[model samples]
Target: MQEFREILVAITNAHTSKAELAQAITLAADNQAELTFVSIVQPAWFENPLLSRDDFQSFWDEHLLAIAQPAMDAGITVTTRQICGHPFHEVIRLVETEGYDLVVKLAEPSGVFNRRQLTGNDLNLLRRCPCPVWMMQDKDAEQPAQAPVILVALDTSTDTPEQIALNRKLLASADHLALQEKASLHVLHVWDLYGEDRLQGPFINMSREQVNELLKETESTNRDRINTLVTTNGIGDAAQCHLVRGRASHEIQKLAASLKTDLIIMGTAGRTGLAAFVVGNTAENVFAGVDCSILAIKPDGKKHQAVSNETDANK
Candidate 1:
């Protein structure tokens, strides 16, 4: 819906998610978009450090070509790429510089290691990458394995407008799928004041009036923004707003579980460096907290600013 004319699929030879790849292909074909298959090769220093640089490059190129073969066989307009350095960084760099409307990659599995728990490379990419990321874990499955259902998760965050806009665009895709399977479009927003108040600090006994005021004022406004967004965009009926209260990610996880959503559409500002190392982003937290499939949108920094400027001009 947002002119996804160019798509980038990040893959690896080692157990790449076929379901995600199939999904990416389906999205591209549906939109008549071109696809670029990108695979990053960690230099095989173990093979031979003394190997010629050209030889190493050739090996990398061949590996990406091999990975690209499957998509090509499916009649996808595919291009192969090989890059050095960290996998996530390379992927993000490609998405931003190449102007890809969407990025499709495998979802990293959980129950693995400690470092990955807080912020793995992929999760970090989801936060900072300037495009949307679709993480797939199962390659053998189709993306819309059973008629695609679009679920958009909303919250009291600064990026909610972009998230809502993205959801509307994805709904267009769902509309396309509606012809095949009954596609349900849902917008979910969660609130957890008790849980969040605990994070605010140790119990400083607050009055019922105070609590009510906060919920009524701030929380109510947050819900209002969500309502305004959906209404303005005509994304769904007002009933589609599934509002709840709890721990942010936990609430979303519960709702996603209850809804059995096929895809969770959300946005993140992939943060890194000392600030992130100290306090991680919610997008990364959501990744660790949920089992449902996700499509993560990252800020391009200027995307919002540019949109605001155009809005002012039109006004």
Candidate 2:
């Protein structure tokens, strides 16, 4: 299992939850990793006449100290920094320059409805960060008092080398987290018969029985792939494996809810060209629908070099 050597925690606002901070501290201590508390200071903070620059600086110093003291006490190396720039850009800059392997932040809710949603900053980090980004949702006050559950979503339909490696990374991450939290691990793969509609089209000469047989074959193949992944990861009997046939995003949300998943560990593929502006559609949809925390990992060799270059050019 891959352990995080350096962890960066982004403090987005004054309302950042203590629960989330404690979670980060626990992770750093468990992994024996160095922890850094970072906050982006907007120009408006200094522009306000009610609060002087010195007063603001003093307040932030105290705030960060209070947040970091616990980790320090736990014998984990800790540091704090306040950078003045765009929140998303500065956070990614630190991750790239400092070689932090994991970025943890509390997901901020947006939109008029104020649903449990990932804000624009969270989405940007998930899309472009060089390493894994863990976005934690505020714990529900009435959540059930049961052992924590972690659901890992895997794409088992592809046999490409890159996809295979990504699947392994996801499984490893979830397994490591489950062990750390003493949580139950659940692996899910959502599969469907592709081009089924076209197969049933009027132009195609296909009988209902024939289509049913094809669907069965597709499901079997998916099951075999998922089982292989589970066994290879040494989680065959330890983790509950789920194979559901439906839309990927919908099925993930459904299973996570049913399992009362505390965290979801999944992959976020970073594309090139214009598509790079958005995360994978399935990931974005899952982010919107589920209230559970998400830990998104990118494929190997997909670094933030492109994003960094773009930022430099713009500057």
Candidate 3:
């Protein structure tokens, strides 16, 4: 739980939910951080005959004031800015230039099958933003009285320094969040023997016992790794750890649902060039399956170059 020094909350529209605002305000107040409320006014909106650019500006100013009043009342330093540009691009540009440590925004629904999905803007921020992105989910119903559950997904199979750092980041973020909200923290690691089917097929023709032994060995090694990660991070017994054998994406969704998780803290390994257009496959799949809020982090020095590239492309 790195303390955020400067926090930016992006209002998707006038109707941004109160829950989202409250979450951002609470984080800022708790951290004693400066909070900024921002909204984007697309140039296309000005083309309509009914409204002038000044009218749009005035409307946004009023809207931001009304929504940001709670934060102001909490005695947190606050500012409001309304920029004119593409919403996603403008938000990233501000992040790059202003050095905000965290960006909070409500997740937009993807129209397919009426499922809650991350829109292109949300994905872009998760991919390109240099800082952590907290995407809050809209909830119409009240939460349960019991403690909220926060899950941190880790990939313990890799011993790479980058992956290890990411694991620590995810755990720290999740632990801090759980403490802040009086929530329960759960850590999860999914492991499997890659190409097990191929090994048992005619190509390799390994015996059933041998395949089983390999699976057992794989699980044992993952268990050791996850346990070491938890102990070394000072999490100790405060958090419950789960090691499951299955596909990473599917297991995550299943466990989150079973635990009724409120938020998931996970890493998005940054990509460059053409690959930067999409988030990591595991993260993307989990995003599509679970409707809970997500805090996506990137490993240190892994921030995508999309900001500079986009700026140049626009120029």
Candidate 4:
């Protein structure tokens, strides 16, 4: 609902169903957000680098152009571009240069073991996309014609004032959808003492009373934060929070699957450099590993105001 003037949809040479195309186009039109259609054509040199150019290259371009035509005719201002390079790098560059508010991409097909696996290219973008990324399932690939139940994943470590504000806004949007689809909103907070904090060994040494006390404190804090968020934002009573103990990503993935959620809304810190690349953040770790669709929201730029204030005061 925030004013998003520019959005991008990344496509490929592969065929897309009309429903998928219309969904993307209609969502942009409804939000009054501009749409850019990008398709990366993998060069012939890679698979059979020895293959003749005229035969394979021409066919690739023509195929992509034909695929983009439907989106162009939908009256949803479309910008089409084909890039020849690493799909993830070009996709990242497009997002950086173009300054898209969101990137929409189709969810990869489900394999026997994995429900749906994100391509390495998609994985890279999901980890470091400049904006939130929406992985649309084939059935729900296009815009939701009605209101959608916004399922927000909340946890202790990533809790912040800005994140609460964003979740509040998302919940408000879901409230509107509730009137139409009668959508229900569910907030999930996963608290595992043995999670990435890596305290399982130490915690196991503690007495039963000590462990129960620790979990009690964690649950209390989780509930207090949820209460503060709901009370401050005046989120509807219908929105409820579920607290579970387990690995953060695995617990969240399980909750989303069990709830049959329409969307999984979670926050990311967008951490980079040695700290993150070497040891990934919870959001990044979860994005790649999640089965359900993910809407990863990076903390707003204003979250750094505290650091700026401290620096100025010190100076």
What alpha-carbon RMSD in Å does predicted model 3 have with respect to the real structure? 2.4
| lDDT, candidates in the order shown | 0.62, 0.82, 0.83, 0.62
Residues 198-266, model 3: lDDT tens digits: 998988999999999999999999999999999998989999999999999899999999999988888
Query: Which residue pairs in candidate 4 have backbone atoms (N, alpha carbon, C) closer than 3 angstroms, thus clashing?
Result: 23-142, 45-49
> Residue 129 in candidate 2 has what lDDT?
84
Candidate 2 global CA lDDT score: 0.82
Cα lDDT for residue 79, model 2? 87
156-272, model 1: which lDDT tens digit per residue? Answer: 444555555554554444344433335677777776565445433456666667677777766777688767767766555623677776666777767777776677776565554
Error of 2 at 309 (Å): 7.5
Residue 234 displacement (Å), model 3: 0.9
* Number of colliding residue pairs in model 1: 10
RMSD to the true structure for each prediction, in A, is: 7.7, 2.6, 2.4, 7.7
Residue 259 C-alpha lDDT in model 2? 89
The residue-by-residue lDDT of candidate 4 on 61-164, one tens digit each, is 68767766776776667677767665556666777777888877775454557645455455555666777777665454444565555677775534767766
Task: Point out where model 2 deviates above 4 Å.
Answer: 139-144, 305-315
> In terms of lDDT, which candidate is stronger, 1 or 3?
3
Error of 4 at 161 (Å): 4.8
User: What residue runs in model 3 are displaced by over 4 Å at the alpha carbon?
Assistant: 278-280, 308-315
Candidate 4: what lDDT?
0.62
Q: What is candidate 2's CA lDDT for residue 250?
A: 95
**lDDT string, candidate 2, 1-315, tens digits:** 779989999986544776678778888988989999997765567888998899998998898888888889888898889887656788888987889999998876575686666666666777878889888876544444899999999998888899999999999999989999889999999999888888878899788899999989888988999899999988868799999999999999999998888889999876555675654567767978887788989999895535544532112
Supply candidate 4's per-residue lDDT for 36. Answer: 79
